[model samples]
Target: MWDLLDPYSYEFFVKGVVAATLAGALCGLVGVFIVLRGMSYIGHGLSHAIFGGFAACSVVGANYYVGAGAWGLGSALAINAISRSRRIGADAAIGVVTTASFALGVAMISIWGSRGASFDAALFGSILGISPTDLWVLTGVTVFTVGVVVLRYRALLFTTFDPEVAGASGVKVARTDALLMLVLSLSILTTLNVIGVTLVAATLVIPAVVARMLTNSFAHMLVLSTAIGATCGFVGMNLSYHLDVPSGTTIVLTGAAVFLLVLAGTGGRRLSRTARSAPAPVRPEETVSLP
Candidate 1:
């Protein structure tokens, strides 16, 4: 078994391991907010927007991460601005931004001539192709994300749970939301190299969603989500190597399996609780105040 794994062992494999773990951990950390604030679609939009950056960088022979990060940040800012409008709606805003950004990226690629390889690996992650430079960039993103989330945890939490109250308490809810969105954008950018724009949401949403099913506290949910994400990355990479499959798809499948298992474990119990609670809610006055 060890010798079989030896063929998979190399500098590239090491880089892949490091990149995936860091990306997973960072996504899990930021995903807590994504889940709480209903910003999962924001991850989706930002991922596509970052892909635009990647395309432009590829055309100009620049570093892809830098380009992707820039576009991701831009996407975050766009989402923040649009979502502030009461008319657009958050989900609608994300859809508009993602579609426009993606179209722009595709147009850029078309104008530069169809060099498919750069975008191909980006669309479907190639863990085996992750370079040392990419690993370093990913590590830096991880550190930055961790630091920001830690520093602003309380404020972010307050905003997520009760933005009106947080604003009344003098917390700048709009600013914090924008900042968090920016962090989420970077995270989405980082994971894009591993899972592509289309599938990055799986990494951001699956582990966090599963973690939520397992735990109620935000901190515990963060920890659990990170573990699940890293495990999915590792397992999916290995499975892809062994089975000659796409790493991104395998990783997503692994996450989905975990999500299903968590659902199976707790789904019935939660439903039972909901069913049982109905009887207690029959008292009109009590029911009115209960909510």
Candidate 2:
């Protein structure tokens, strides 16, 4: 309806819509792998870790994306490396590293009194606050993520389902994990502007989980999750402007609503198995059980 489209008469709304859509889609795409690998905590933790960088950069007058991106990447790698020790589990590593980073941010905020960027905005979100630079950064990250998935589909898929098998088949699990963490770090950096650090994990998680309930095929899930996320972003942005709600809150609520609808429609019966147990060659040289 024209009522819905009227907001675009303002250029800010237009940019908000685009940014939200791309941010949501990127989170959904990466979330599929994160969910399959049981790395849901990583999403939550990395967002918190990025917050530390956000606060530090804001205080120092540095480029937020660059500094925050590096900090997040380091946190992710540290978690991955610590988990690999077999001494500490991934969950513990996430809890320790990210929480420490988050604590650092809190300390900085208390000390600096929220200097450069709006502390409230970083914690929450403001779609109207989006700039041309933010949009371009978001677009670039989305393109890069898509490229990584497309070009390295087999390895990523394998890594998600069965890293042990993947490693046995010369898949280089460590490198794949590092690359994924890199993508995730950048995505989180871009996503923070649209949805805020608080809600990034939900944006990353909800769409992928919803898609999983709809289908067992990994490829189908990817497509469906991306579509769902984009839909939520578009619809939520419009609703937020009309309702005067925070754009990030509205977007996540929209995804949650979609989740409930799918949950009810599916009757919660699709609680099926993952591809970890069964061994099937999806293609020659790829011994992944593509669920």
Candidate 3:
């Protein structure tokens, strides 16, 4: 047992575990809205878009968080703006913008030799390299995300399920969407170091998907998803140390395993139609706030 748990003796391992845990929970928290809104692609797209910014920041000698954070926020807003247009679908907008940003990053890597961003580490993640500042920032982002969700619960739920009614109910649908995008962009930025650019979406998606399998209520799904994400992070970090695999890969694999187990155990019966990813109708009369 001492040998099995030997990695915990190191301080870096402890910090990495904590950072991954927070990132996982944070991703799960915002992922629900993303999923319910059929915006899961945004998580994948924004992370890639931010990678482009990360590469640019490295070239310009800017701080990763500041430059990449702003870039991601801009990309997210752009996606929202483009998607708002009637002609362009949200998926199309995400594809065009994020793919272009990713391609730019690739081109820069080809031209500038990956600069300071370290392509491999950025793509696959470098959990062990998490600094104290990054951990603190992740913690702050988590708290901020929770506050946003709590404060904007009614608005978020209403906008997520029925934007037409949400707007009618004085929820400010457009503003709510932009704010959720802001929080999502921030979550992806902070989690990038822990889960890497490539697998960050999986972290965002898997926990929420699993939670949905277990519950029908949006409120319950949110809480269960957060717990699953944190558990995956904690377990996956431990598995990464023992198996000598990438932390992001291990974390995603952990979630995937849970997803499979749940699917098998429940035999697809646990998921009610209402609990599925498609937004269930929320009539004005049923818009009473949930605790």
Model 1 TM-score, 2 decimals: 0.87
Q: What are the Cα lDDT values of the candidates?
A: 0.73, 0.84, 0.84
On residues 115-163, what C-alpha lDDT tens digit does candidate 1 reach at each position?
Answer: 4335766888887658777778778878888888778877776776667
* TM-score winner between candidates 2 and 3: 2
After superposition, the stretches of candidate 2 with alpha carbons farther than 4 Å from their true spots are: 272-291
Model 2 worst lDDT run, 10 consecutive residues: 281-290
Tell me the TM-score of model 3.
0.93
Worst 10 residues of 1 by lDDT: 282-291
| lDDT value for model 3 | 0.84
Q: Candidate 1, after superposition: displacement of residue 139 in Å?
A: 0.9
| Candidate 3 lDDT by residue in tens digits, 203-277 | 998898888777767889899999999999999988888988888999999999999999899877664532444
* Cα lDDT for residue 269, candidate 2: 64
